[model samples]
Target: MTPFWKLSAAGFAATAIAYGPARMGFGLFLPEFRSVFSISLQAAGFISSLGFFGFFVGLLISQFLTARRGPRPPIVLGLAAATTGMSLVAVASNLTVLSLGVLLAMLSAGFSWTPFSDAINRQVEERLRPVSLSLVSTGTGLGIVAAGAAALLMSIGGVSWRLCWALFAVGSAFALLCNWIALSGAGEASGVRRPLRWQALFRRATTPIFAIGLCYGVTSTVYISFAADRIAQAGGVPGLPANLSGSLVFICYGAFGLLGLVTGQIKTLTGLPWLLRLLLLASALSSVLIALAPASWAGVVVSAGLQGINVMMTSAVLAFWSDRLFPAFPSRGFTAVLLAVATGSVLGPVAAGSFASHFGVTAMFLATAALAASAALAIRSGYISETPHPE
Candidate 1:
């Protein structure tokens, strides 16, 4: 494989482990976490909320780390954190240790994503940026698959959540090694260290992009943190899936989400603006299906497929759009995108979790649908500007 292709491979490993298992995997196994800790719905939501906050912190640090040094170190650090953190979660006996493990794993997401994007961008020709990024986004789908497979394995072997997490940590170690080999020296910054310009980073022209980020952030998190839980709920106990088992729903979601790898092709046909709008609509439609008929296998299958498509499409759009708007500072543009995403990460679980705890999971999905609809309106209203094209 070419060097850029190698970078893509490393990125896939990093993202799969960091975002997929370290971050998204938490929701997949929230039932186990709650059972072990004897926590309430509110508590599980709060724990996920904390993970997002850690994600925010990691984003902030990534801004500096990628800016000064390069992608490899931050990627390495993030993967290491994931390796250690998930292991902690695996072995923890109390709430405090479990919380710490969760925090570290989420924080690893911050470190892995942006830096690697920088690395990938650096490795590829300009024409290939969107395609490359889309390839990396697919890693999340792969990672989710890994997590789901682990869940399936757990079911087959009667493995404990703790044991699964330990296995995840081992997987992270492999990811870290993949990154080290692929990005070492290849991704390190070369020129004089330049500070991120706040003015450019927060310019008025990019407002619409930020708005898209916000909409995506809120909607995606609600789904990521709760989608499986909803599936499980429909499948069993008060908050747990006592029926089809957690792995089945997650495998469906992960498998369908792989559609995002084609985001570059969609962008090529529709352009960034329309693509965002369309995907947001897709998200809304998926949310409604799930909210209206959580237990329906048809609804669940379609919902997972749609959610998977939009989730990857949204990320590819943001990266592609940023390339069009701020070619000089991809990292900062990504930071803005992630900041909105991470901000939503904070709000999504809290709102969804609390709503689910009080009213029902369906109510939370309805709220998410509303969020997606508003985002589509924002796009239609020119919140992003009238056909932004890079010079």
Candidate 2:
């Protein structure tokens, strides 16, 4: 395979495991998990918050590891962490074990995501880099679709959650081996490594983008964590079985994955600035749809599809922005945005769940819609710029 395709293929599979199963699977499996563990909504939210805490810790340390040893070691270590973490979750006996498993799995996304930019920058030709990276990102959608499909089967066949986690782990292990070989073939950087710098973390241009990421962190995480439960509570697709909402999460993911394939083309058409703006608006609309879906079953399906596309667009655009801002130190830019994302992810569920415990999910989503609109305004008002400014 061509080098660009090699890395793209590897990155795609790894992301599916890292983001789809190891990390995002928590939200997808919340119903079965909470029932099996007798977890309260607040407890579930707290667990999700704890996972992001692990993600934050990993995000902090990955750059240090990457700075000293390039991107290869950390990527491999992350895949290992994911594989072990999912295995642990599959057989977990208590809430503590499950949380630990989730934490480890969540760590995988942090470890795997940043290095790819550096890798692609190294391996893929400049002209093909954007398209290649976009293609790799669709892996998250694929992972989501896979997870959703698994859940669909489980819902249909009455399979155990234990099986779900085990399958996710087994698949991750296979993907890990492929990712390791692919990354290894990309070869290590040859020059003396640049010393990790603190100043670049605070460049003026990154601030707005980081804030936008923060909004995504808060709203999107909450939606992922609680939206399904909300659908179930609201009586789930009106005509369909209530138990199938979990399965539908996969459908949403499938839609996301399929739509995500066009990210490169979409970026090429809209360009970054307009694309970011449109995504913010699209996000706001999606949130509104989620908030209102209880009244109309058709809205549930539409909301899920929109959410999938909006998220892929946002993540793709963010990755593009990070690479543009920090050509040599792309990881640092990614690190900054991730830290922002981590903070929002950490806080989002805790706050949204607490508010939901009082005002309910509908209210929570409307509040999120407000935040998404604020993000759009922030972008429109010049917090995020189209051009990269030198540090």
Clashing residue pairs in candidate 2, if any?
148-250
Q: Residue-wise lDDT of candidate 1 within 1-391, one digit each (tens)?
A: 7866887788888889887889887788876666678977677778888998999999998878777787777888899899989999988999989989999999998998887667866778788766676677778888887788788777667767778898899989998888888886564676876565657666567788787787788788788777766666666423434533456556777888777667778777986668887899989998998788777667777887788788876776777677667776666767877898889888778877888889877887998998898778666544565334343
TM-score of candidate 1 on Cα atoms, chains taken together: 0.90
lDDT of 2 by residue, 354-391 (tens): 88778877888899888888877766545556465455
In angstroms, give how far residue 269 of model 2 lies from its true place. 5.4
Cα lDDT over the full model 2: 0.79
Least accurate stretch of 10 residues (summed lDDT) in model 2? 380-389
Each model's C-alpha lDDT? 0.78, 0.79
Candidate 2 lDDT at 373 equals 82
Per-prediction TM-score to the true structure, in the order listed: 0.90, 0.91
Candidate 2 runs further than 4 Å off: 125-128, 257-274, 381-383
